[model samples]
Target: MESTTWEESVTDSINTIYLLFSAYLVFVMQLGFAMLCAGSVRAKNAMNIMLSNVVDAVVGSISYYLFGFAFAFGVGDNSNPFIGSRFFALADVPNSTYDYTFFLYQWAFAIAVAGITSGSIAERTQFSAYLIFSFFLTGFVYPVVAHWVWSSAGWLSPSSSDLLFGSGAIDFAGSGVVHLVGGIAGLWGSLIEGPRVGRFDAFGKPVPMRGHNATLVVLGTFLLWFGWFGFNPGSFDKILVSYPDAADQGNWTGVGRTAVTTTLAGSAAGIVTLFGRRLLVGHWDALDVCNGVLGGFVAITSGCSVVEPWAAIVCGFVAAWVLIGLNILALKLNFDDPLEATQLHGGCGAWGLIFTGLFAKEEFVIQAYDSGETGVTRPYGLFMGGGWGLVGAQVTEVLVIVGWVSVTMGPLFYALHKLGILRIPVEDEIAGLDVSSHGGYAYVAHRDEGHPRYYADYMRLQDQS
Candidate 1:
């Protein structure tokens, strides 16, 4: 009995280690997000991009660790309507539940969403205002939604199904909660913040603002794609709740379905975007192509575990279409999306969830209900006449989410605007964040001849207005 008990203890320890490692993979995506922002910003503001990414993750995670975790998972049982309330500062997590593992994983997600907002408002928004938003948004709004979807007791829990309520939304990862919410919030920020000083011409037409480094964009995009493998499939609450007698399948293939669809969609989006940009712009844009891959990944995230192999390819193509259109609209509207957050994460994430409604086989829905089954039968797509019922559910859900985020965020931003604290002083904006906040220059792009002097002249014209 003694020997057997010792072996069992050793095995349990290993299981805990594996779960933690997988969660670590998910955490590293924040670095990927940071790089993506770096790739997207203008050369002059590269430090700004890097700083926002770094600080948002640090501040957002700490804020979440402090209180956000409890708000999302504090409920005592599977049947609670509200988020867990007892875990403020994470005080009550049972030791048996791998306590900090859940905290660690969910915190990564919160950081990612907060990081999404960073890019949208990067160039001109004040770091002080950003710090404020990160505190409230991550610690409150985001956790409340996570509680709704991922928390068992929340109203949208799988066991709490209602067509109108969109319970068990099959988000797989976080199309609605993370990406979509970020995107809508970003849209609001961009709208109320308005374009950067000269992002638009006097005629209100768009002006081109190029990212500093195509190579950085490509590398950052690749990093995000790689990390997504851990993200979508890691949605399995099963990882944390291990069965004592269950068979071990290393890195489960049901999770592979999520990986497969995600990769396929990203690839399809990349190809389509490259060709589309070439056909339209007369030159293929590496940055646009990067966005395409990201767009596809976001598009497939919701439906990844719910769709068939072929459906993934189709989904990717469709998501690319949405991405291209939204990006074009942003430029035309003079929204200076420093990192294209709205089109890539917001637009694609919303579509991905709707795609789940269209492509998810009824059988898969049943499987997701039961917990370990892959629900291969449930992956039937609209091509097979899955019909408008699922489609309608998706449409309604997307509209509600978009409406919920936009309506609330828009007003919040407008109020922030009235207060005049939304942006940094003009001198700070010109100096870049490294010099302004960190007391050092991050990248030497400022070393290029005439950059500061260049911006200085431009600032005078704007201030004259």
Candidate 2:
């Protein structure tokens, strides 16, 4: 009896430790995001970029907690195929220790994925509009898609999914759900907001907006890389080595394997991003080096669990190439995705999802190791001879999300433009968001000798609205 009790205690402790670590890593990714977006924008906009990240992180968290928690996870009567109808306002959640623990852990994920879109809209969006968008996404869109995969009754769930792909859509780690949703939204958002003023001339010759500080960008990139281990691997329930044969898990193998694949692919992305940048540009750029590491991790997320470590390397390398290309194309298209969210998360994420269909190993599938599947339904990837059906499913999902967000968001933003609520007034845009929106300055204005400063601060401000 004592031995059994001790084992149970060990399992409980392990669960807590894993959950805590994962939560920490995910939470810190926000800082990486802040720094990344900040660096992408001009120095004049740095404070505004950081402030938006901070606000959305806070706002997204509260909204997800208050209503999203239950709607995404609360069980239904046999589980609904579309929306999670049970936990409407987090009312059904109990006060048990597990309930609170589950809430906190899941909350971190909601925050990370929801905030991913902010990078795309960093400089130009209205602060008020962004706050509203974050709440709606966390409370409704992000959660609903999350349920479609993670919830027992969600339509994407293998047990109940009736899609043409018998095993359901194959976004093993939210490539289709989280990254794509944010990417599509970011694309539409950038389009509606339009290219930043002075970003292009009448001929559309691309102009470069050099980032404020490369040092901050590098540090932020490191933080994101550190956090992803927890983000991908921690999606699994915590496993206890002492209770290797416990009902929850047969071993710690899944988590360990996931970490290996995640890091390996990230490494591949780093090298490929390095080479791609060197070959494509005059030299390997620091910004590419920083984001290339991230590009790898994002590319590997979908297949991290199923692919071999070396396959991860290959996937990451390919994804790095994709990311760099997308960034270049984005400039040509006049899409001002300042932080490259559309590339790093959306482009690489899509690549990762498709790769999962190609490289997943057979034994890995049969091991009942996919924490995403909740066991029961085992689907094969291309390497395992599953063929093109799963790939079709993944494509369908990407279209569904992109098409849905575009249709809904495009018009909404256009209407806001008409109403004059989308972008701030021209004067405010010239003044910078820190002073106009956040009511503060991000940096000490340095003196420029012999440079006459515009004395607009003393002039009465006029509201465009």
Candidate 3:
């Protein structure tokens, strides 16, 4: 008995360390978000956007600690399908079922949701509005969605006693829960704010308002890619649990496979986008490829653990077209999102959930959902002959996420707009937020003796010399 206790203690320690490392990796994605948002906007708005990203982390930490974690994972004697009511302010934490490490891991995810939304309204939103929405989103709107899908008492949870359609939605790593929630929220915010000034010409023609630096965009993309290894594989939450039928294999095997699928999906999408954009626009563009890579990652995140590697490649292939097609539609509709947050995270994220419904393997599903322990096999991928139950659940998840975020975030943005605090003024936007609102340009070369046109004057003088 003593030897058994010792073994269990070692396993617990190892799992704790694993979760903490994964949380750290996920935290690094915040830096990636900062760089990506900074690079994707004009240099004038770089400081503003980067500052919002910073605020997302800081505000998200406090809010999630005080309420978001409880709303997302807190359980009580009278557990409900929607929203948690315990552990507020980290009260009664470190219990048997949940620990500090778990809270830290979840907090990382909560911040990521806010980061994704910040990209949609970049360049034109008021900083005060950013703070209000970030706090509300990370603390309330997002946590409700997390509860519905991740909490054991959630109606949509696979672990729920009464599963939706006998197989709850398989958002293995939050394609719907995180990416879709963020994306849909962004969609509402962008739709209400309209396009950024100068994004569309007088006659409704599209204008290419490119970012100032491509190097930063590339750097940010790579950092996000590196962080995704933690985002997907780390969702497993443990690497020590062994499967009953498999000899010398466990969740560790699933973790490795998830990482591989993530890599292949992103890589395939990047390659496809590189060539697809060349054909569409007669030029190779790295920015398009980077967005495509992220889109693929977003799509495959739902099924990274349950789908085969080849299926992941297919997911990426279709995901590239989905992003390309969405971009074209966004341009036609005159809907301007600076980071393509809605299309990449919203559209591709929806596709990822469907892909899971179509391609998830039965055995992998059993392993991922812990159905083997219950001895009750759940429905899986439609194409794999597991039937329509799982696919129906996936479709339901998409529809509900769209409905939920739209209902919640849509009105908040509209109210802010009505109150005249959502978007910046025309003069401020035209002069660039950095000069009019943020006090200075992100690049020092643009700042010359407190004059706005200093860089241009300096250039002309150098030419004369």
Candidate 4:
């Protein structure tokens, strides 16, 4: 008995350390989001967007701690399918089923949702409005969705006693719960705010308001790619459990396979986008390639653990076209999103869910959802002959996510717009939010030295001109 207890203790310790490392890796994605936003916007608005990204993490931390986590996973004997009902403010936390490391990992996911929305309304949004919506999103709107899909008590959870269509939604790493929710919320916000000032011409023609730096976009993309290893494989939440039938194999194998699928999906999408854009626009664009890579990642996130690596490649390949097609539609509709947050996360994210329903392997599903212990077989991929139940569940998830986010975030943005605080003033936007609102540029060419030399040189140059 004592030896058994010691073994369990070691396993628990190892699992805790694994979760903590993954949480730290996810936290690094915040930096990636900041850099990506900074490079995607014009130089004049770089400071504004980067500042919003910083505030997203800070505000998300407090709100998720106080309310979001409770709403997402808190449970009791009276647990309902719609929401969590206990553990507010981290009370009674570190319980048998969850620990502080779990909270940290979840908090990282909460902030990522907010980060996605920030990219949609990047340059022309009010900072005060950003704060209000960020808190609401992290604290209330997003948590409800998380509860529906992730919580054990959730109706859509595979672990639920009563699963949706006897399978529930296989959002293994939150293609719908995180990416779709964030992307749909962003869609509403962008629609209400309309396009950025110069994004469309007078006759409704599209204008290419290119970002100032391609180097930063590339850098941010790579950082996000590195962070995704943690985002997908880490969702397993544990690595010590052994499969029932497999000898000397366990969740560790699934974790490694998840990582491989993530890599192949993103790589395939990037390559496809590179060539696709060349054919479409007659140019090799690095920015488009980067966005395509992210779109593929978003799409495969739902099935990274359950789908084969080859299926992941197909997911990414289709995801590239989905993103490209959405971009074209956005342009035609005169809808401007600086980072393509809605299309990449929202559109490709939806595709990812469907892909899971179509390609998820039965054995992998049993391993991931049932821990390979339950003898009961569950519905799986339609194309794999597992049947329509899982695909139906996947479709249900997509519809509900779209409906839920639209219902919640749509009205909030509309209310802010009615109050005249949703968007920045025209003059502030025209002069750039940095100068008009933030007090300085992100990069300064000349600084006042408390001397006449700089002023005299400036005056001479002005006179010459």
Candidate 5:
């Protein structure tokens, strides 16, 4: 093998470090999701919710390492647009350090997809079934969709000759690949698992099942917001390798612009949601605000590197409105999503993709185009005098992703249902999964007299008696 040049070695080291740092930030999202899910359920099921989050990281890591990574991104020339053909069980890579860093980053993304599905079935689903679903989801379902968009050979990606419109689909940070796939899977899971107990009333109106802790929810939301900095900016992957030289300041453009747009979009959505909530219900809800912030993040993710800042604000504001309407509509249609993952991710993710097609600037798109690395030109957006081709491509992606996830996950969940493992026993659910499934309460401060924790403490006190 040829010896590496000093510049190449330095650039590789920098890339690895930056990717790992970004992965760390993304990994922190697991904590945010855990706390968020825990806060969204009743106190009785809090442990179960937190445990599921833990499971996402553990199972997701192993599964992705085994097959998920390979399926999503193959090693060497085995990778194709439709699917990856090698790297099973994480066979050794040629570039161990850099490859491993990339794997770690992608691993975090796989875990996130599983974690997103967990909240929709919270408080009612069986742990065993969720474990199974997570394995397959990361191993296959998610990878297939990811391959279609992120892989160099993907038909819908800029690299493929099968481009549908303009420069093909543009998902700067997985508005469709990550958030949409997760949201659609959650939608199907909710439908198959059915609503949580007492989710609907005798009059057929949706009944609210309020989350136990608002403080935790807000805290989790803040963490997620913080993580978005790494998420949106890190997608460039080019910024990290650029040295701060006179001519190299341009490298910072994508990272800086993405960060700014991400912040503005999230902030704009939060503000819009606050007012929208008041006008609709005469009261503002903390949960709604949190979801609004997340919705905005999802909405701007696809366009953050390509759109102007003002367009980001418009995306966020509209995302809030869409979320509000989508939530109400889901309730009316009997779809139960405790964390509103469906509306926030599904609705906002689609909007992000479409919004990019409308508002993406010509120069920014060109900057991010990476000189046909994906095999397509950086087509301008409609509002930039580019016409409707990009918009059409985005819409096509949205429809294809929705259909793909639904078809794959819907049946899998239904089969799990047939096996009698899809959900816990109704009695177990009513009494709470913590006591019945996990054998403990999440909060002991308010435990009933003779609760298990107290019982355990009492028994320990009399040990050897």
Candidate 6:
């Protein structure tokens, strides 16, 4: 074999560094998920929720390593539009120079997507069953969606002849593939597990089950927002080291635009959610603010590189409304989503894809795809003189993804339910998952003092003693 050139070697090293750093940032999202879920539940189940968050990373990694990467990004003629058939145990993956870093980066994404389902099914789910679900989710369900949109041989890819229309499905950082897929899975899991014991009264009225800690929820939201800088801008990985043509000139434009769009959208959505709640409910709700920030983050993720700043703001604004509307609709429909995962991830995720079709710019889409003018089929936005073709494609993509996830994950949960392991016994649930599942309370103070103490109260007690 011929020796590699020094220039090629140096570029590969830089790309590897870039991806590793981005993967680290994405890995921090695991802590965000832990804090968010732990704080969202009652104190009695906090440990269980936190454990599930950590387990998502642990089990998701192994499962994805076993087969997820293969299904997601595998190559070769055997790799079809629907699924990849190679690298089941990551066999021969080390042969390629770029494979390792890419695998780690995508592994982070798989774990993050798999973690989304944990919150909606929290409080009453069996710990063993959750581990199983997370494994399959990373290994198969999530990878299939990633393959469908992001893989070269994917039928939904703009480059694929099998594509329905337009530029095929643009999901910059997986608003649909990651967020929507997990959202629908969470919805199915929640429906299968049924509501918590007291989620709804006999009259069918929803009861308020407030989270025990608002501080952790807000902190988790901030962390997730911070991590998104990597999520959106790092997706510009392709162009960062591979500006091969004049059309690829100034590729950093897409990266910088992505960062700006992400920030503006999150900020706009947060403002809308915070103030909107005050206007509608007579006071600001911190929980709503946290969810709103996340909803904004999810909404702009798909179009951050393709849309203008103003369009990103619109996406955030619309995303916050979608979140609020879905929260109400879920409650009215008797759905029990503890962290509002369905609304924050599912509803906003679909909106993100739709908004991309409405606002994506032709030049940026060209820049983002890195194939110059020929890379994408229907590159312009509906409002950007591109007409309705892209919009039609986006809507179809959303429906197809939603249908696929629902059909696949719904039955997975149903099978688990039939095995009598999906949900824990009522007595164990009423008693609290921390004690029942883990054999201890999250806070020893609560066990010792017989009542939970606020931080201020704890300080006061220390002073008195």
Model number with the top lDDT = 4
lDDT at 319, model 5:
96
RMSD of 4: 4.3
Write one digit per residue (lDDT tens) for candidate 1, span 1-465. 445487677766755665566577777788788878887775557776787778888889778977888788775543245555744655744467456666777788888888888788888887777887777778877787777667766565554544333334566688888898898888888888877766788999876667667888888888888788878877663443332234453224466677788899899999999998899899978888988998898888877777787888988898888988988887877777878888888999988878887778665555455444442222234555665555555565577667767766778777777888787666666665556655555566453311355676645543553
Off by over 4 Å in 4: 1-4, 95-98, 446-465
For model 2, residues 1-465, the per-residue Cα lDDT tens digits are: 435487677767778777777878878888888887777776667887888888878998888877777667767473365667645655656576545666777777787765778888777778877777778777777777777766666676543536447666656567767787788777777887887765777899876666768888988888888888778887665555323234554436777888898888888888888888899887968888777888788878776777788889889889898898898898788778777888888898888878877877765554434333333455567766877766676666667777766776667667777777778765666666776676556776611110114324322221110
Which segments of model 2 are wrong by more than 4 Å?
1-6, 77-79, 159-164, 241-251, 368-377, 446-465
Predicted candidate 4 versus true structure: per-residue lDDT over 397-455, tens digit per residue: 99999998999999999999999999998767766777667887787742221123354
Model 6 pairs whose backbones collide:
none
TM-score of each: 0.86, 0.88, 0.94, 0.94, 0.91, 0.92
* Candidate closer to the true structure by TM-score (higher is better), 2 or 3: 3
Q: Candidate 6 lDDT (Cα, whole model)?
A: 0.84
Q: What lDDT is reached at residue 246 by model 5?
A: 31
Model 3, span 1-465: residue lDDT tens: 445488788888888888888888889989888888898997778889999999999999998888888788877763468877644747735565338888888899999999999999998999999999999999988988888899888888877889999999999889999999999999999999999977988999998877768888889999999889889999989778887776477788899899999999999999999999999999999999999999999999999999999999999999999999999999999999999999999999999999999999988998888823546588999999999999999999999999999999999999999999999998677667787778888888644422445545643543453
Question: TM-score of the candidate numbered 3?
Answer: 0.94
Give the C-alpha lDDT of model 1.
Answer: 0.73
By TM-score rank, best first, the candidates go: 3, 4, 6, 5, 2, 1
Report lDDT (Cα) of residue 228, candidate 5. 82
The per-model lDDT (C-alpha) reads 0.73, 0.73, 0.88, 0.89, 0.82, 0.84
Off by over 4 Å in 1: 1-15, 77-89, 161-167, 239-251, 372-393, 426-440, 445-465
Off by over 4 Å in 5: 75-78, 86-89, 92-94, 240-250, 371-377, 445-465
For candidate 5, the 10 contiguous residues with the lowest summed lDDT are 240-249
Pairwise TM-score winner, candidates 3 and 6: 3
| CA-RMSD of model 2 | 5.1
